[model samples]
Target: MKYFGTDGIRGEYGGEHVNEAFFEGLGAAVSAHLQGKIKGRLPKIAIAGDTRFSSEPLKAAFCKGLRGVEVADFGVVPTPALAFGVLKEKADFGVMITASHNPYTDNGIKFFDENARKASDEAQEQIEKFFDEKISGSGAEASVKKVDMKSHYIAKMGSILPKGCLKGLKIALDCANGATAGISGEVLRGYGAEVVEIGISPDGKNINCNIGSEHPEALARLVKDSGAFIGLAHDGDGDRLVVCDENANKIAGECVMGLIAIEASRQNALKGGAIVTTIQSNVGMDESLKKRGVEVFRSGVGDRLVMRLMLEKGCEIGGENSGHYIFMDISPCGDGLAAAVKLLSTLLCLKIKVSEMSGVVSLYPSIQKALKVARKTPISETPTLSKTVEKIEREMSGNGRVLIRYSGTENKIRLLVEGKDSALNEKSMAELVKSVENDLQ
Candidate 1:
């Protein structure tokens, strides 16, 4: 927990833990931990990275720490591609050098087991233990091989939908100038859709800057101008997505997930007749899915937790409101391209306009805010904030909810107030924010 966050180990590049020295040590630590798990042969690791300038150097440092291991370098690919490569190669583990939606100034490491699932908390703890020890290598250099994982990943994505399912349709895309730059556009065009793209040019420094899922204003404009049927925006490392309809209206992730859940349920394709989502997801989605006889399971706020709950419930699909959707039938990890393909296929089958898809769920009025703090104080320890939250819940009288928690990845607090009355929700949120700020101060 000291190094790992909600998703992975991330921080500003060149920071204490994100620098080359730490990465080299981490590489050695990971290698050491895997040694005990494998049998005869040496451990193997599949590695890939996004388009950040720091990615290459960081990767080299990580590779240096591996002793007597086979390393496959998939080179500047999306995080999901690295996961896929791990499964295809049957490697002991995989590593992706990225910070996802973070700016180019930040970088991080994500680990996957041979099954292509994100490294669980237990696995990370074992690795951290090894990281604390200065273990010497056997002096046998790591055998590094450069593999072409993009072609295989592209082929897999292109095969998801029926051939030419997107024929004559125009699709707008924003790749965030990161991992999906070349790949997403190529896959969409191959599906017979006329693809218009932006944020596809990665200059290393420009990734996630005023573009991507985190910034969909530009993509919305593009969708309107191009007359595209829908607009898909992917974050820096291509694991997250944001969507907009032809009219340039942005669609919430909850609505997107509801639409997919309903369609999958109708086709009897939804495993366990359920989907796993996070607590952060809107209650409207849960209510809508319930009406259609599809159960919604809520987990903590992370794709890894969502996936874990999905496995527990025997569900085939799970996702977060942040646009990280997982389809166990396709890939263990969230894939933006894969999610986009699923959404398109669902819309095509339903024969509904993207704009009209919003009717699938009617979201309650909500006000959300994030406040940066010098430190993360536990909400339970903050009497003022706790009292304010309880009072707000009592006033709402079960018609709404209040959520307050510190971000697992950043030094900040996130607050959410949702209710039937928009005015009450807004007022309650302001009071909550004031209480949180005062407590922290």
Candidate 2:
């Protein structure tokens, strides 16, 4: 909690905690950590970022902190690209600068290990501890050089997708005016799809502004109006994905995972016959997979936690409901463009539409509410709320579920209720919300 969150160290750009001085310290900490791992050799660190105006300055400060380290500055690339480059270059690690789907006013910094995995909790803690220490560089001025990784990345993807797999498919894409602006379209075109791109232009201020996976309704409208066969929208950092059918009906991330599972099963590619998801995922996904004899594993929320379970369970796929997906067989981190290509390939191979394929999972009606609270108290310490939640669970029994937890980034408590009956779910949610408010607000 000192410097990281469910995602990363995110705050308002230019704020006290997220400004130049902080990132400079963070950079030095990262350099020292990686240096310790390599035992005094020059550590190589790759960095990339989204299109936010603050990204460049923060990145500069971070690199300046790494005066003695070898920096591969992948200018203005997606978060996944940085992860991929880290592994491809055999660097010690990498960093991504962007607040993901958060508003443009915010920014963040996250690291990936040499294997492209999220930095472990222990590693993050070490970085925080070192932030206060003054570490000398290599006695030379910092010089961050740019690297181009798009061609190599696209070629790797090309090998996985069948030749001309997307031929004649009119695909619509919403790049969210962020990292994937020009990158995603080129990949789809290379696969032989007629790409209809929106949110392709970024003015450094409009990333995810009423666009991207957080607001797929806009892309759905574009899909319907443009008469495209399918639509894909990505969050600002190009790590999340949301899709729409030809009719423009949006498909939830879990539903899309279900569709992928079916294909993987048919091809005997579903390792361990298991899938991993977060507790936030709809229980309907579990029920739907049960019929196919596929086991479901739940981890704490966050893509990092989801991947942890996947690695332990030997599953080939895992993701969150927020559209952050990991096809572990392809990449360690989430890549929205990779997910889009896989979906397209599956459709071609199955000769089915997105609407029909997505129907593989039937979900119960659910409601999610994030209530702003003045403070965050441990749920165990809030007796009133705990008792109320227990009573609600007893009443629901086999009919529904209740999950309440605090947000890591903000002073908010997220409440989710899913049930066989919408009215019952709503009633239970209201009671839980009030209980939480009374105890924490």
Q: Which candidate leads in TM-score?
A: 1
- TM-scores for all candidates: the values are 0.98, 0.96
What clash pairs does model 1 have?
Answer: none
- In candidate 1, stretches whose alpha carbon ends up further than 4 angstroms from where it belongs are 136-139
What ranges in model 2 sit over 4 Å off?
134-139
What is the number of residue pairs that collide in model 2? 0
| lDDT of candidate 1 over 1-441, digit per residue (tens) | 889989999999999889899999998888887877876889889999999999999999999988868999999999988999999999989999999999999999999998999998999998888888766345487899999999999998898887887999999999999999999999999999999999988999999999999999989999989999999999999998899998999998998888998999999999999999988888988888899999999999988899889999999989998899998888899999989999999998899999888787778878889898776777777878889998999999999999888887778888989889899998899998889778885
Top candidate (lDDT): 1
What global local distance difference test value does model 1 have? Answer: 0.91
Q: RMSD for each model, in Å, please?
A: 1.0, 1.7
Q: Give model 1's TM-score versus the native structure.
A: 0.98
Q: Quote the lDDT for 281 in model 2.
A: 95
